[model samples]
Target: MFEKDQDKEEWTLSATLESPASVIASGFGLDTAVGEELIVVKAIRGEIYAYETDLSTGAWLLSAEVSVVDSSYVSSRPWNQARDIPSLFQRVFLIRLED
Candidate 1:
């Protein structure tokens, strides 16, 4: 992406070693609930999956299958309007379960 008034930045898209799976992912939610490093992907199949970084291969691996019924990401955050968090909570910690 570029702006009309700004200088153009040239870029190229290339295939990388670290890439997502073939399935169509509807949305993404970061699982910082317990200070664990995980990337969560909500697939089109109505299933949630958590992925972890494979240090040796520089790629992501499936860590766990998050149950949508019990997982707070979809059930709590997406619909709940009063879940706004402060910057301090975000900086020092992540996803305070209480507030």
Candidate 2:
């Protein structure tokens, strides 16, 4: 949806995560609502990827590049006894689903 006087667009969640770390999502919704879309995707480690939506097949049919930003170094040592501290992340992308 778009406002008549504003040049902005909107996204509404057409799907939801099926398991742990459930996050409400929409392609267009309020900023706070859309911001929650990443909770489920950020639960895992390793490479993550995205694809362009393929309208012909009704899918996100193209595999985009995957990027890994590991913070294992931060969790490498024990919290109390470790010599070095580990890095952390605010988000992680794990699953991809089409609605």
Candidate 1 C-alpha lDDT tens digits along 6-97: 34322211122222321111112222322234333232233333344333433333344453432345335432222322211211111111
RMSD of each: 14.4, 16.3
Error of 1 at 34 (Å): 14
Where model 2 places Cα greater than 4 Å from the true spot, the runs are 1-62, 72-93
For model 1, the superposed segments whose C-alpha errors exceed 4 Å read: 1-36, 59-70, 73-99
**Lowest summed lDDT window (length 10), candidate 1:** 90-99
User: Model 2 over residues 1-99: C-alpha lDDT tens digits?
Assistant: 212223422112234435423443422111111122222222123322222223344333223333333335322322111122121121222234344
lDDT of each structure? 0.28, 0.27
TM-score of each: 0.26, 0.23
Estimate candidate 2's alpha-carbon lDDT, on a 0 to 1 scale.
0.27
TM-score of 1: 0.26
